[model samples]
Target: MRLPTLASTVERRLLVNYRVDPPAISRLLPAALRPQLVAGYAVAGICLIRLGNVRPTWAPKAVGLRSENAAHRIAVEWDGPDGIQTGVYIPRRDTGSRLNTWAGGRIFPGEHHIADFQVHETGKELHVSYTTRDDATRVEIAATVDDDLHDSRLFSNLEQVSAFFRRGSAGYSATKTGHHLDGMRLDTRRWQVTACQAQRATSTFFENPDRFPPGAATFDCALLMRDIPARWHSLPAMPVETDVSGSVPSDARM
Candidate 1:
């Protein structure tokens, strides 16, 4: 009897669902503090908040700057049923100065999925872009911030945030989890992925400490599989629950 030889196989992909764009470098810093804060973008659902700031150890006063100042803040909220997502920008010269506050809730109607967001600097302008999917509807948005602004701190921070979503929780209530990444700390309950497709989609909750000073700021992002037996209407009509104690969800079991 003759035996046949077997071939070995290698899997090239990792199990992680997140993908990060290469960190972009810039010389847009003051001469003395140039080595401290390195500017870059991180992608999450619908584009997470971008950031540009000096390192924690570098005191703003060392460069004749104040820590209590913000150049501007741009906020975008989606309302699923109304078929519109609204964005607002507030410019602040001093930290004590307050921008117009926005309440948290659904900002747009019929929004099913949101992703592919980026914020970049072009000369003196700041640009932001994102894609929204509402049921059978699809739309893309690109906006720019072009005003003579000497505040690099606010611009640096805004340039660091980006987001992407796999599934649509159109009416789900988001919980907060207390966590921090880089200088940004998230203080809220954590969200768990319930019914994700091909392990590409997962749910996460984050709170941006820099933007929401005293109160906690929170948002959600996830990756979704392209095609499967699942339809937008096949999912449950209930909101996914959050684990305040960091317990894993039962639905996450494969």
Candidate 2:
């Protein structure tokens, strides 16, 4: 299906970043896409967002939907016909709205799993938590609004990190066989992000010592944005070659 453009209010967004080993990042990326490195290490993270009043461009605002969604994303770039394309590669998507899971794969890219979410905001502080239906993924973020980055190895400062993600508005989702890149782009009039201090944060996926190893993955920085007008638009899937012979057929993967 052709991707559709969605309009909504980014009621809240928690961007928790992690710096991972280049090799670890490589294992997660699909064909053509490479981790957008900072300094030398690869970047990856969890994008937990609360979207409000979401609806199709042509639909009435009164009929919009709201949901809490999370994506495990990797900062990636690839060589395209035009030049180098920078964006994110999403491995999994979990949403509180069951409608999203139902429409996935048909109305849009297939979603990975459905999960319940809890969000609480107290002045400049916020806490968001969630777990998948099967309990495979569990995450939590307790943070306070701030203008300081406590720790980061990938970029020198917050601006450097923000600037990198600003140009990476485009994103692709991985398929089951890890061959196809389902495409999507984030549309925002402007990026207004603030630095955040993570009082405590955890993600089972990135915190796995065996997978990320010691020093391989560590907390870089956290950012928060609120009340931003944005849109989600579909893009053509990027086909990758599995070998030197030719492009891998779409249906052949899964």
Candidate 3:
């Protein structure tokens, strides 16, 4: 049985975002979802996170598990029965924990691939890199905490960027079945973020030319969250509408 909620400590999270041409992002999303635009540009990114003390809400903290994870996501919105709803659509998930890979789609939300991760952190800086076991994905970033958003064309300031993401806490993940999306929501009581400057960043998923044509995507800004208490809740799955081909594109799977 799936747990109602899982509690965890957000040891670290880095959102390395990109601004992409709207049309390019549209092709990859299922028909039910449309890219959520900012300044007429679609937003996509890699979320590199490290979670500690993760366990069912009823369990003691001492039994919690820790893991390093990554997700490739796109900001999206869809027509809900109530109105327009906003969230993120995750195409792929990777983790260093075997337990996460085994329990993800079965007990939580998305299916996860096993990956190897290298991480180094200090008070002011962070460096992380990972590669999936199948060699289908790789990502790396070196960033430092900063006081202001740097060279971001999407949002005018750090506050605006932070608020934008806070509003899109719900995320849907693509499932192997392709007929529906697995959903989850992140809850944090003391929500806080700091602007970060990525001195170096790379993502094979975003950099693939076959998926994103030349000049379609560009680096934006990064945000960092550290030492936060959080909870994860599963949501009802949403049915998807696929194209007439009756199959999701291979490029959609990492």
Cα deviation at 108, candidate 3, in Å, is 0.7
lDDT of 2 by residue, 1-254 (tens): 68678899999988999888898768655567788888887888999999898888889889989889998888888988899888988877888989988876657664557998988987699899999998878999999998766677676777877888888888787676555667888899979888898988899878777566777788888988899989988889787658675545332232
> Each model's C-alpha lDDT?
0.21, 0.81, 0.91
- Candidate 2 backbone overlaps, count: 0
**Backbone clash count for every predicted candidate, in the order shown:** 43, 0, 0
lDDT of 1 by residue, 9-87 (tens): 1101011112222221111111111111113322222322322221122234233211111111123233336764332
Off by over 4 Å in 2: 243-254
Candidate 1 weakest lDDT stretch, 10 residues: 6-15
User: Per-residue CA lDDT of candidate 3, range 193-253, in tens?
Assistant: 9999999999888888988997899999999999999999998988877668888765454
Q: How close is candidate 1 to the true structure, as a TM-score?
A: 0.17
RMSD of each: 23.8, 3.3, 1.2
Q: State, as a TM-score between 0 and 1, how close model 2 is to the true structure.
A: 0.91
Instruction: Give each model a TM-score.
Output: 0.17, 0.91, 0.97
* Best-matching candidate per lDDT: 3
